[model samples]
Target: MATIAIVYHSGYGHTAKVAEHVRSGLEAAGAQAKLYTVDAFVDAETGPWDELAAADGIIFGSPTYMGSTSAAMAKFLELTSKAWFTDGWKDKIAAGFTTSGSLAGDKNETLQRFATLASQHAMIWVNFGAKPGYSMSNSDFATVLNRAGHFLGLATQSLNDLPPEQAPDAADLQTAEVFGQRVAEATKRWVRGAA
Candidate 1:
């Protein structure tokens, strides 16, 4: 069985919710999956980097802050420089997701940044393959092409003062799950072809 690692940082649990859905999707697809929160890496005796290096696929998530990823996630990426030097993630399937507080939040930028980092490590990138809803669909609230990125893109409407727990509705969670399943399926294909 292939292994998939979901690594992310959640400022107020919104991104964490997305990460959980992603993890569920991967597990449901028959892969050995694990969720690693950036918070744990700060002081944990052993971080998830080892697992990440060994996994066949990796998914990254982070909350958008000031048009980018959380500082914690950024730091995590910076730390991966060591792994990059050693080509630890070469040939892995990589994807990214992000959540922001508003429609105009720079969530896409965050995902793009992660995708670029993945490319730097010579990894294959995956994008959300779900068909886009018509512009009139209530779920299609964001602007056209709003979700564009190397991999699955998700947005939540967190109106002022509303927390992510109450902001991202069922639709957002469902999208995340599908994204995860797609990645797992793609990873399986890659592994089979490699063998």
Candidate 2:
């Protein structure tokens, strides 16, 4: 079975919701999924490197702040420099998801940062891979699974001041769930091929 690690930093808890949906999807797809909060790792003793090294895929998530990933996520990335040198994450499937306050919060920048990080580690990046559920002219964002129609990665827009428990909406969360499942399926195939 393929194992995926969902690592994220959620400032206002919005990103955490998204990460959980991804985990659900992974588990539903029969792949083992582990959740690792960056802040938790920093505050406690989490041997994240060992988990990451054993994972067949890694899904990174964070909330967009100042048009980029929060400093917390950035710090986590920086801490992985040792893994970079050792290529500990090399060949692992990688994907990213991000939540922002605005519909278009330059969230792509954050996803691109994820892609770049994955590339530097010689890992393969996976796209969101779901068909768009609505057109631009549609007014019901709630009906579309991928409301933002993101192609590179999953992008979710949550209200700026609202609590995450009420923000991601059913559609965005469902999209994340599907995105997670896709990554798991891809990782399963990748691992089988590697073996």
Candidate 3:
């Protein structure tokens, strides 16, 4: 089975919730999924480097802050320079996801940041693959997936005032599942092809 590592930083729990759903999707698709907070890899000398290195794919997640990735995620990205120097993650499948308060919260930029990180590490970046779920006037927000219309990766929205439990709704979580399944399947294929 393909092993995927979901490395994420959730400031208020919403992103973590999404990551869990993503994990479920990965497992459903017959892949082994592991979740790791950015803190796990922040300390270079004592990090879970072996676990990540063994992963066939990696999915990055973070709460969008100031129209980009959070400060914590940025720091984590910088720390990955060690892996970059060693080509540790080369040829692995990589993808990303993010959440924000607004429906159109410049979230694509954050995914772009992640894809760039994957590119730097020579990883194969995977797009979200799901089409926009709210493209038509008849579509209902409550039932639609990929509501934010982002193709780079999973983009979810939550109200700033609402707690994580109430925001990011069922639809966004379901979309996250789709994202996870796609990545897992892609990783499986890539791994087999490489073998």
Candidate 4:
């Protein structure tokens, strides 16, 4: 079975909720999934570096802040430079997801940050494979997947006033689950191919 690690920084719990749904999907797909908080990796010498290195895949998650990943997430990415130097994550499958206060929250930039980081470490970056969910006139706005139409990775929206429990809604959560499954399946194939 594939082992995937979800590394994230959820400032207000919205991203954390998305991570949980993603984990559910990964588990459903027969992959072992674990969630790790950015706070635990603030110090390079500390945290579960070994666990991350052992993971077959890693999905990065963070709340979009100022049109990019959160500061905490950025710090974590920066700290990965040590790993980059040693090619610790080379050939591993990598993916990303983000939550924002607005629908078009420049979330792509955050995903780009993740992809670029993965590229720097010689990892394969996975895109959100599902087509846009609200492309048709008859499409239901409330129940469609990939409603925001982001291709680079999963992007979800939440109202600033509403709490995490209610803002992301069922559609976005379900979308995240699907995304997780896709990544897990892809990782499994990639691992088999490598073997």
| Top candidate by TM-score | 4
Put down candidate 4 lDDT per residue, 62-158, tens digits, no spaces. Answer: 9999999999999999999889888999999999999998888899999999999999999999999988887658488699999888999999888
Give per-model CA RMSD.
3.2, 1.9, 0.9, 0.8
Give a tens-digit lDDT track for model 3, residues 95-178. 999999999999989999999999999999999897887765848988899989999999999889989889899999999999
Question: Which clashing pairs does model 2 show?
Answer: none
Each prediction's TM-score against the native?
0.87, 0.94, 0.97, 0.98
Error of 4 at 7 (Å): 0.3
lDDT against the true structure, per candidate, is 0.77, 0.89, 0.93, 0.93
Winner on lDDT between 1 and 3 is 3
Which candidate has the highest lDDT of all? 4
Could you give the candidate ranking by TM-score, starting with the highest? 4, 3, 2, 1
The Cα error of candidate 4 at residue 6, in Å, is: 0.3
> Least accurate stretch of 10 residues (summed lDDT) in model 4?
132-141
| Tens digit per residue, CA lDDT, model 2, 1-195 | 899999999977999999999999999998999999886556323556787888899999999999999999998988877788888899999999999999889999999999999999999999999767876687688768887867889999899888988989888999888998899999999999999
Which structure is stronger by TM-score: 1 or 4?
4
Cα lDDT over the full model 2: 0.89
Per-residue lDDT of candidate 1, residues 1-195 (tens digit): 988888899878888888888888888887778899886675333576677888998888898898988999998888888788889899999998888777657677887898899999999988887655434554454433323232345544455576766756666666677788888999999999999
